[model samples]
Target: MFENLKILRRAVKAVATKDPELRVQRFYLIQEPQVEFLDRSTHYMNVGFWDGDATTLDTAGEALARKLGEAAELRAGDTVLDAGFGYGDQDFLWLREREVGRITGLNITPHHVEAARARAEAEGVTDRLDFQLGSALSTSFEPESFDRVVALESAFHFHPRSAFFREAYRVLRPGGVLAVADIIPIDGATPRMAFKAGPLSFLKFSLPDENWHDGSTYAKELTEAGFADVTVESIREKVYEPWRQYMAGRVDDDEYRRKLGKALHKGVVRHWSGQDVMRQELDLLDYVIAVARKPE
Candidate 1:
């Protein structure tokens, strides 16, 4: 009972916090404790690619990573830049499977960077992985520094994602690939749909500052940023529906609900429940994977 009270207080406080960065920090702080109970081997935060009944959360996540890698044409001995790398799960996968030469992970959250760094060290890949605390919009890396740049489900939070495109183009070597998996307002989605999604969804997902651009807009931005052969593919049915179903199943489980309830009170599980509402009733958004290349 006392623990529940504490959790409720945290949830209230999280809702009250107006600053975006502080809210993000509070949200993750609530999530940290729950990580131990989750599948720690692949701490993926993205919506996974579910092919069929054979897909588990980990495998789905790996499939998404593979999709991004294929889009980027990732190869051994390539230096990759991972923008907004959540927990560096995909980085570990890439290291193990793709045999990438090196990875520089940039994330706005400090704890995520620290946790990812620790995981890399534990996996004996610290020499090949570097985690930095920073934003994707503006990075400090030198020009033409990376062979590939990728953001897995994180670009949506980049305020005006166009800036990140230009920055990626600046940092990537000629002929380097830029790949992203992101969420956007569905093509031709009406204003009413956005309104129905509600403010909580927007705040929780950090979608407001993103300008909610669709796939075509993203492709145009990449092209304007000097990327050639830009392609944006909507995989909403494959990603959003399956992901929503998976999350709904998890939330339906008694044990998971109990844990989530506690986490919600503590503000660690903000906006998760709201996702179901968005998925079921709103249908205002789509999941897309985009790829482009810098010309030589």
Candidate 2:
């Protein structure tokens, strides 16, 4: 009962707060129930990149991280700065698969920082992966410190994403790359729909108005931030619809029902299956993988 009240209070604060980072932080803090229901195995908080052979939730999330690595042209012996590193899943993937030299992760959420640090220690990769409680918008890293900067499914909450872009440019080496897997409102999403109050009204709190831009504008932002070779490629087809289908299937499963707990299962089935609100909300979003580079 008290926990429910706490979530209610946090939700109200998230809706009312003008600070984008705080709003997003509160949203994530209140999303434990939703997160558990969505991904049962992994700590991946992304809307998975679904494609051939990436059917399950965990595999699809990993595939999304790998896709970002490919976009960044991540190479061995390159140092990486993972901004908004949720659970440090992508950092682990890059260290093991891509053989990146080292990764330093920055995140605003203390819970994520603690959890990721624990995971890093348990996995015996603390030397290569460091998770710190910090903001991507204004990092403390030195200029030209890293070879690559990446944000996986987390840049949208960066208040004004342009600030992070400029910071990325500042902290990256002369020839470093900046890669991002981000979600933004489509060009067709007008002010009304973007700020509409309804099932997905939480988006109004989580996504800043400045971040509601199309691909072209996104590329322009990167260019303005002193990045060259900017490319923002849409991959919405493989992210949203397939994820909705997978969630629909999972909500219908008895095993998932047991796993999600009774209250969350009922709520998810109600809003997700009975009303189809999730699909309606997703239709208005566009997912893109953006790649850019600092000139040598």
Candidate 3:
């Protein structure tokens, strides 16, 4: 009962602390004039996760969604799992568009859970999908389940990616495939440095994850985790180049983007030196995808 009460309090606090308008402004992706997330004055957020109370998404959020879906090889009737479910937009959107049968979504954030639930109900996929408040390191589901599991753009926020890989492998049935997608570092990402900037900041300041390395080393980890047919392939078409273009496309010209980028960098430096340090650095894993299969 005490645990349940604590859970309820956290949920209530998550919803009550910020107004919906503020959330939509910084994190929601509906940017048309008629929609809530359209205003341009909002501070930068990476595709809707709040960083320093800011609300914003890259201009290529929609395009990136399509690319992510394609990379996951989504198909109809696939029993899927979405790890690190964000606002639930990508999973919800992909499942519905692809007519996937059953999808279970898990994330650490209460705000993400609530939003994902609301959006699923709104989209009328609530019956086919289930949203749970959980973590990638440990999920609340039976083992040897799910046809495909995707950790799109959210895996790097998980520490020791090996744990998640093990969990994913455990929950996947023979012949089931697991795909991990996220902004990974090519190299030079120490546990300490990982604690500093980019997506890791969200985990450190607000959530979990203090050790996030790029998937370059994850292939060995996955192999050691007992998965077969393990391959760490780069989906360059879907990740960095597109992301750079998408975020860059929001402004009118190069000059405007440069100005905004500098301003955003200045704010990061003021609030988070870790993020400030990464302002112009490009990572080989600015976008990457890894696919492995549980032995059939």
Candidate 4:
């Protein structure tokens, strides 16, 4: 098919490029050609939370958002700092479901920021939402400006994730909560296991420079960043297994093949899909929900 050929060519081109930013951009672009197949309302990119209650992708994604929100103890009047706010999906959920007062989102991706801003305007929540082109490590916001800080399934992409913790601590008000739904390499996981998982896992998701760490490392970093009562809970079974099952079920679907071709073209779908690698090597990774608070 023409789509498959296009995807093949894109994959070759992506492989030839060495720029990390460009590679990331290419990976996101994979969604452009497959938007119709995705749940556009949520625009979710993380592993869904399947707690036996969620029978559909939208509800699973909402479950994950709710879990993060509860972990952060989000209050109706709270001002939130959403780091890596992917397409503003979770932000919209918080605004609608939690009635959060305002959210200032930081994202490195320009197009995502633009889309989020447009979505907010369309939903008449523009006054309550601000999406900016920025990284979690560096931001222009004043110290202690936000009541809560959250990074949903995105902290893993932050190179040296500790830096983001420090920045989050700096930006959060005293007594503010910091919550992250993140992917961590299991303790003692080695490069060999990552390599064996294939190109998407090793090159795209677990880049050497990213310095992905385990739960303990993350907890230590949070404490060092001046957070108190830090907790890191591994919920891989609730996240990975069901998400894998859902995705695997869709793998052979007609719509999924079309999307897979786009992912392939972007060089984002390597030898192994996420579900395949996770099922085969469960010990190499863990999904975690981490929460901490700044002292009042």
Candidate 5:
């Protein structure tokens, strides 16, 4: 009961606060460094891209990263800026799989930076992976510094996300691509969804009101930020529904229960275990991969 009250207090404070960055950082601080469901040493923080026998959380997470990397057209000699990179798992994947020349990851959360840096050192890839404490919305990069900029599952927390778009536009070299795997509200969702998602999704997840919009508006924001050849595609079928099913299945699994341990007592865990409830909550969202390029 005390823990639940503490969680409720934090949720109320997050809702009342205007500092989105701080809210987002605090939101992530509460999450386990190793996501409870993943059951792997590698930590990934996203709704996985479920497709083609990618049944595990880690594999689907890698698939989503690969999808974003493909959208960015990652080349062998590219300098990439990963904005709001969580734990740098995708950076490691891209470095080895995509063979990107270098990756500079910027994140606001200190623990994430520390954890990612420790992982980089452990993997002996410190030279290629750079994780720094910074803000994506207001980076300090010079003009035309990177060949690609990507944000995986983290853009929605960026307050006034358009500022980050402008920042991405400014930092990328001419003709360079920008890609993001983002979550936005489904247009015309029912009021019950609106009410539930408002505090749970928006407040607890640090989603700002400005970031709540459909895919068309998302593309328009990139276009307005001086990106051309923009594409915002909804891949919800591959993202949300499958993820909910997987997680709902996990609720009854022994391994998952062992991992979560005492967290099972949390009200949120009970809420998540109900498949219909999870479906309704997830149905309110649209998962999209948005890609655009700076004009040459």
Candidate 6:
């Protein structure tokens, strides 16, 4: 609620900047269209490049699944759930690899579910993949329904992070695994780095105006929510250089490269007053992933 309050103030300020005749849909931290587009576009292109097994993992979603899947000894035939299944890449990979028996994906945005379904159809894995619109914080699924649940880089949009973890625990079977990858504040809840990173990153994270939390903070939240053996692995360095080069390589050689690149550049500048908000995190992970499990 604190975060949402801050965003409400910004929205009011923005309305002031405008004619004040039009009321922005500032309810629930919805970003201005331009900011949302830029953030999504950059994530799509950059993650697409880093995701080697994109048949299942999406180039448009987070890239840590492949690593975490391996780290957790996850393999084919398990029932998997992609909690915030944007682009359906992680589940897609699971489906294609036959790693999971079937994967149920839930996403808040209809647009993501639409694209994910289409991709599943095109890839001929429709039978093994299913996606629907729902909030990760309070999705509807029977208790003990899955063997593995993952929310890759999509957890931050879920405020009071505890709720999100609690929900994941609710639906997960005992001993089922839960994995989340997202940005957290390092030095308390400071908005400084976030403000500098600008709206592009903040919008992507659905950050409240601007808020940051350290990785440890999220780890603690996971534990509080009843996830056992919580672990936080920083994949920042491996991702930084590769992600930058990948973002840089988004243009040329592909179909929409020029158009998307141009749009991305303009969007970045519009939101952050610069076209390279992700530039600074080239050394450490812009964020980290937290993995935990429901006790058997």
Which structure among the candidates has the greatest lDDT?
2
Model 1: per-residue lDDT, tens digit, 74-144? 89999999998988989988988899999999987888999899988888888899999988788889999
The order by descending TM-score is 2, 5, 4, 1, 6, 3
Candidate 3 residue 3 C-alpha distance from true site, Å: 33
Which of candidates 2 and 4 reaches a greater TM-score?
2
- Residue-wise C-alpha lDDT for candidate 6, range 62-170, written one tens digit per residue: 3465665654446678877776666666676556554678888887666568878988888887777888877766766888888888876666655556777888899
- Native-to-model Cα distance after best TM-score fit, residue 72 in candidate 4, in Å: 0.6
Q: Any residue pairs clashing in model 3, and if so which?
A: 26-55, 26-56
Q: What is the per-residue lDDT of model 5 for residues 27-55, given as tens digits with 9 covering 90 to 100?
A: 76553444443575557878789989678
TM-score of each candidate structure, all chains considered together:
0.84, 0.92, 0.66, 0.86, 0.90, 0.70
Off by over 4 Å in 2: 1-7, 33-39, 192-200, 273-277
TM-score of 6: 0.70
How many clashing pairs per prediction, in order? 4, 0, 2, 1, 0, 13
Provide the lowest-lDDT 10-residue window in model 3: 27-36
Q: What are the lDDT scores of the predictions, listed in order? A: 0.76, 0.84, 0.59, 0.77, 0.81, 0.59
Model 5 poorest ten-residue lDDT run = 190-199
Candidate 4 lDDT tens digits, 1-296? 46546655756665566765566555565435244335335677777798878866778888999999999998898999999888879999899889999999998878889989999889899889999888888888899999999999777767668889999999999999999998777863555334454423433443435445678887888999999999999988887667666655665567656645664433434343665555766556788999999999
> Per-residue alpha-carbon lDDT of model 3 for 186-226, expressed as tens digits?
55353433444443333332322333455556777888888
lDDT of 2 at 168: 98
Best by TM-score: 2
* lDDT score, candidate 4: 0.77
Q: Where is model 4 poorest over a 10-residue stretch in terms of lDDT? A: 199-208
Per-residue lDDT, model 1, residue 183, is 75
